[model samples]
Every structure is written in structure tokens, then in C-alpha cells.
Target chain A: MSRNLLLISTSTTHGTGYLEHAEEEIKSLLEGKKSILFIPYARPGGISHSDYTAKAREAFERWGISVSGVHEYDDPVKAVNEAEAVFIGGGNTFVLLRNLYANKLVEPLRHRVLKGMPYMGTSAGTNVAGRTIGTTNDMPIVHVKTFDALQLVPFNINPHFQDPDPNSTHMGETRDTRIAEFHHHNRQPVIGLREGSMLRVKGDGVKLLGPHTARVFLQGQKPMEFKTTEEIHFLMDAY
Target chain B: MSRNLLLISTSTTHGTGYLEHAEEEIKSLLEGKKSILFIPYARPGGISHSDYTAKAREAFERWGISVSGVHEYDDPVKAVNEAEAVFIGGGNTFVLLRNLYANKLVEPLRHRVLKGMPYMGTSAGTNVAGRTIGTTNDMPIVHVKTFDALQLVPFNINPHFQDPDPNSTHMGETRDTRIAEFHHHNRQPVIGLREGSMLRVKGDGVKLLGPHTARVFLQGQKPMEFKTTEEIHFLMDAY
Candidate 1:
């Protein structure tokens, strides 16, 4: 049986700290599902496996969902095999890519997702769903041993879309400009998800969530903005 | 009919309260050049254009080399054309990129280089030589309203190479892992250049500068280290 996949971006929980509002989002997704298998992948920024597990447990308990950390399960394959849904939390994108490469988990995770397991990823986790985890701003918090990601989605996701800071002194590139550069090099529609917003991928399309707006940036064209109620079918072509 | 270009990447300057060490390197580059044109194209940090111009002027004055600020020239083309050599000083990568985009000077500068004018970049200035300005940790102090960069070099340059900070509590990817991730998606080698070090690109090949070591990271491979004397032909391939 194929399960649904939920991907939550790391920026979504960046405000309330980890596992606070994330619990509410997770519970809503896994309301009736039993044996929810939580995979806190993309643990960049030097976050230990235990810390991610604890965050998931806090959210799972609030929703009355049974949650188990896959990292503690000696056999990750077994843990993933029995789970009805998968949740990927965000942190450092490179660290996540490193762990995924070290464990050779990309293929296995892809296989499970293909079999219809519901998968969820937030922030850095959401980064993995794209063609490559190249757009993440998570500093290389760890030495990246490998760079492999679950290429489920076609384009990159830029989360935490807030207005530019006025007092920041470090000037390298803004998020909008970075995505524009990405478009200049690669012809892909980068999904810019503002805070309190999401792209819910259903059977063959993605539906915007929350009241925030989403911006689709493509090369050689003006950026197109969308509202929460908009249905984005172009995501089907992303893969 | 071509001017010289000088790129300067310092080990440390006085602003960060760090000791200055690249003064000699700057002097050596400007030693024989009498009619020198100083271009402060990469002052992303709070280092004002006048401040950078003044710093270079002081350095050159010590070496008896006449340094003049070309930024005051209303027409950038006229200013660049009249110079015998162009020198780009370092600061913040984001700020540099933003200014470059705002002025739309990337192509004109590249044209100058192709015309056999001497070109040089230091720190963030050196990074502008790459295809994309992605390997910078400089904060986005100013919103440039665009992410355009001077794609002189194909690979991303990670300045200020050091081991992971043990005391940093900030989460997410480390600098190394982030560059590694960039290597995964990008075939071009990501070069980690330590302070006082530089990759001097001549006509056909590139030579390393300074005494520090550089690490070239690629996807699916261990980081390959190099020395100052090594001739990096692969860099041409990146372009």
C-alpha cells in the first residue's frame, strides 16, 4: 500500500522554534493514520539525531499520534517499511545530504515514496524534495561527505519569504536575486513560499496552503505571484 | 590599448579588529604600474567606496604607485577605458554582487578583460570571477533587488577557509558542507581559498597565489587539496 508524503519546509517552524507549531501541522496531516513513522532527515546545523527525534515526539504526542524515531531503529529499512507516513524536518541541508549519502538512503526513500507512502518535509526537508538541494541557505554547518537528495520535485523551494532586512550589513545576494540567478542558469520555476504558507502536493497537482502568497520565479520572465486558494498544476511538470 | 586588472583578497583587515597582512601583496601587484585606476567594485560590507579607495591609495602611496579612484567618473566606460590597470578590493560578497548588478557592469568589465586589460579581484572581488556568486557567507546587508554576478570564473569560490567552529551554536549546514552540496549539483569544482591565497587566472591557465592551501571539492569525490605552485587547468574547463 502506498502512503501519502508530507514535506514541511524548515522555515515554517523557524518562528516558534522547533516542534511547537510543527506538532499542530503534523497532527492535522496524520490525524487518523496509525503507526506514523517519523523521519527527521536533513539534520544540518549540527543537530544530533536525538534532538530531531525529540522534536518529532513532542509534535506526535500533541496530536495523539504514535511516533518513533527511525534513527534509533537499528534497521532503518524496517522502520520505514512499516510506517504509514513519513515526516522530514528541516535544519542544515548539507548535513542532511551528507547523512543521506553516507547511509545510501536516497534510493530506499525514493522507492518507498513511489510505493505511495505519504512523505512530508519542511524547510531543509522541503529542499530535498526539489531536483537538487542547491538553493538552501543553511550554511555548511558540517563537512558535506556527499550531496544526494530525494529528487521528487522538479524545482527548488525558497522558504521563509520575508521582506528584506533594513539593518543587515552583510550584502552577498538576496533570496530573490539568488533564485533569479538560478533561473538564469537553469530554466525552472522556483517556488517562493512565504511564512505560514505551503505547497500541498496531491494526486497530480499542488495546492497552496494558508493565507500567505507564493511566488513562482522563472528565468526571462516576470515573477508570478499566487494566492493560497490557487491550484498550481505546473508542479506536475516539475518532476 | 588594454589596461591591467588587479584583484586583492586580504587575510584580514583592520575593521573586523583583525590584523592586516595583505598589504605587501597589494603593493607587489601595484609596484610598477604608474597610471593605475582603482575600482572598488566589491565593497559589500560597510566599507564605503571612498574608504576602500582611500585604503588602496595609502597602500600604493607607500610603494610610490599613483592610485586614483575611478568610481567618481560619471561614465564607467570612460573611467575603465582611461585606466592602465583596474584593481578590485574586497569586502562583502552580497554587497559586491548587488552593486555589480545595480550598475550593470559585469559584461563591460568582462569585455575589458577580454580586450587584454589587466584584471584583478580579491576576496569577494575574486568570487565575482566565478559563474555564480554562491559561495559567500557575507550576510545580505543590503537588498540589491537582484542576484546578478560577474560570471568570470565558472566555479564558486569559498573565501576564508577554516575548520568548523566548535563554539558556533548556529544550526544548519557548515561552510564546507554547503560548498560540497554546491559541487553535487554543479560539475564545476568549488575551490576553498584560504586568506592570503588567490587563483591567478592568466590567458590559458590559472596559478595559485600566496602560501596557503586550497581545497577543490567535487561531487562524489574526496576534496582534493593543492598548493600555491600548482597550475589548475581544470578552472578553464569551469569557464
Candidate 2:
């Protein structure tokens, strides 16, 4: 079986409702699937696992897709293994990875996705789909056993990547600088997916979705920006 | 024996010279010491360890205080133990922590610092003075053996803490929200030390130092702001 993945930069852009911008792409990717097993381990600030799950459920229910939180199952590993489709929502990457390790579902989840069970991730969710969680923007609130991630994709994904505003005077490092620093210590290519953008993968092919340009960072090279319409499948083999 | 530590939020403010803003405080902290040890493991971007060390050396040489890069020594553990004062410069927290572990100097450095050796850290260096590196804003370009830091202080420190720019359209979580999310999983109090700010520690007493107000986040309570002159020794016992 071939793989299918919808790795979104963020669930929502500023001033938009949750997952609203990616609704059409999500519908197409999850077409004909009755439901999705939601991993709510990344729980955003002040939200419970059930509440986060309910949020995911509400988003999918609008399109007539049922949702079940993996946390609600008796065995999370079994739930991930039997899931028709898996959807990991946005939040803290460290907590999400820690929970996945605790549940011993990292390999099971990866195996299912690689075997063609539909997989989708947003923000922290999307971060785990890459080579490692080294590019995450989330705070490291907890300790994970390792930085190794699912590696469903060949390159790491830096979601919600925003370009530096020329007018700002903040002395802190920009997103580009951070990714460039990552390249100093890592050889894996990193795709900086801006808001409203996503990577749609089917089999061995991938396409950049949405309207914004994606920034690509290669080790020992300058970062380059690519329009949404560009063919970037070469990223998978460019390492 | 008591500890003497100076944890600075940033080495420089906008448009300022390197370590220029805190030069006076740094001199006072290292009073009577002829030389200091510099750990440049937090090398930023493409800068080499020697270059980063040279930058620190130049900053301290202006005050007649010499600097020796710990990386240049054959035995980092022995060097850290024999150092008059230890200074860790700012950059990527993960890389700094990784090098500390790789050199097998985490425990040795911590022991010396706790035994009355003066210790100074800026940004990433300050982040490691806390119990763990959970509140760092840097990208995880590499994996450390553990998030456990030197624990020279009782609580976690969020260096270079900036308030949200209301005019911006970016939807990423602010420093406050990130720390709040941290409290959801941890009970440790986090001090959001802004630029141009620092903490001066002497034995069991610590005083906030600088011109800006530091933000403090307790687990469930609202974040409170404290003036630089306020006595914050209670933080050591709060958790």
C-alpha cells in the first residue's frame, strides 16, 4: 500500500476559525472515511484531553465525518493500529511526543500510516510526521525520551513559518535564522510551511497546497522560497 | 559555602554593543577575579566555538578580566572546577546542554558553582541555570541527553521574554501563553526575564536587576509583573 498524508502548517490562520482554511483539502483527503482517530495529546493551554477531542470532533462533524479520540480508547496502541484514519491536532510537540512514547504507539502509528491508512497532522501533529521534532516552535514543556519522530516524510516540516517583518525591531532571532541554525547541526532538509499552507502527499508524490510560498532550508546553503505551484517532490530525495 | 550567580536575560539590547548593557553588573559580579571561563557551546548560526569565545573574550577584556574558552581545554571538567568564574554565552539551549552532557561536565560544573564559585550566564546560559531547559525559546536543532539543567536556581527561567505585539497578525503563541501551557504539565514557577534584565543571586537570596519589569508565572495563578528592585528571594522557596 502507498502512503497518504495531509500535513498542515496550522489549524487556523489569524482571525479565522479552527481548521477553516484547510476544510476543502481536508475533505478531499479524508473523502469516504467514516471517522478519524484524533490524537489530542498536544492539548493547548487550559484545554482538557476531552475538550481538545471535542474541538476536533466539532471541526470534522461539519463535514459529516465522525471523530474518536485515541485517549478515550482502552488501549491507545490498539486504537492507533485499527484507526481508519488518524488526525493529530496542534499544540505542544514535547507533550505530544512524550505521550506517544508513553503509549508505545510511535512505531504502530508510523507503520499504519506508511501502510496507507490516511494520516493528517496540524502544527505539533505535523511536526511529528517529519524526520524529528527539532524544528518545532512549541515550548519544550516536558521531556521526551528522544527527538526522533515518525519520519513519515523525508524532510522536516516547520509549520506556521512566518517571514520576518522588515518594520519590526525585535532583536530576537527570526524564523529563518532559527531554521538556518538547525541546518548547522542537522543535514535533513526543512520545509518552512507558512500559514494557510500544507503538504499533500499521496504515494511517493507530494504537492504544496494553499497560496503562500514555502521556504526551503538545506544544510550549508542559503534558504530559498518556493511558490505553492512549484514541483518540490525532489525534496524527498535531495538530502 | 554559598552560590554567587548572575543570570542575564540577554547579552545585548537592540543597537547596543555586546554585553554592553550589563557590563557594570558583570564587573561587579566578578569582582576581584582575574579571569573567567567561557562556555561557547551555544554557538549561534554559523559561528565557530573559537569565534564565539573570542567575542566573549573581547567583551570582558575591556574590563581587564581575561577569558579562556572551556572547549580549548583538554579536560573540560577539570577546567570548570579550577576556573575562578564560569560564564556561559547565549545561543541555542539544546546545543549548549548537549555539549555539557557530552563533555561530562554538567555535574562537575554544577558542583563548583554551588560551592561558592561565581557563575554568569546570558540568554541560553541563563535558561540552563533553572531546574530544566523547558522554557527556552530556541529551536531544538539538536537533542540533549536530558532537559535537566544545572539547577543552580530553584525555578525555570524564560530568557528574552517579550510581550505580544498587538498590532501583528501572526497567530503563534506568545511567551506568556507558552509558559501557561508549561504550567499545565509542571508546577515550577517561570520567571519571564525580558531583555536588559537579570537576576543577581548571593547565597539563598536573589534580587531582580535591571530597568524592565519581569513577568512571573505561578502554576494556576495569573502572571504577575515585578519591578527590578523588588526582592524575589521567595521564588526559591515557592515551588
Best by DockQ: 2
lDDT of each: 0.64, 0.91
Interface RMSD of each: 10.2, 1.1
Q: What digit string (tens of lDDT, one per residue) describes model 1 on residues A74-111?
A: 88877777777877777656567767766667777877
Cα lDDT of model 1 by residue, B127-166, tens digit: 6766666566543333344343565655667776655657
Query: How would you encode candidate 2's per-residue C-alpha lDDT over A1-239 as one tens digit per residue?
Result: 38899999999898789999999899998998998999999988758899999999998998999999998999999998888899998899999998899999899998999999999999999999999999999999998879999989878999989888888656678898898899888899999999889999888788899989899988888888888967688777844
Residue A132 Cα positional deviation in candidate 2, in Å, after optimal superposition: 0.4
Off by over 4 Å in 1: A1-3, A11-25, A141-148, A166-170, B1-29, B34-120, B123-135, B138-239
Q: Return the TM-score for candidate 2, rounded to 2 decimals.
A: 0.98
Regions more than 4 Å wrong, model 2: none
Deviation in Å, model 2, residue B36 alpha carbon = 0.6
Question: What docking tier does model 1 reach?
Answer: incorrect
Best by TM-score: 2
Looking at model 2 chain A, report the run of 10 residues with the lowest lDDT sum: A230-239
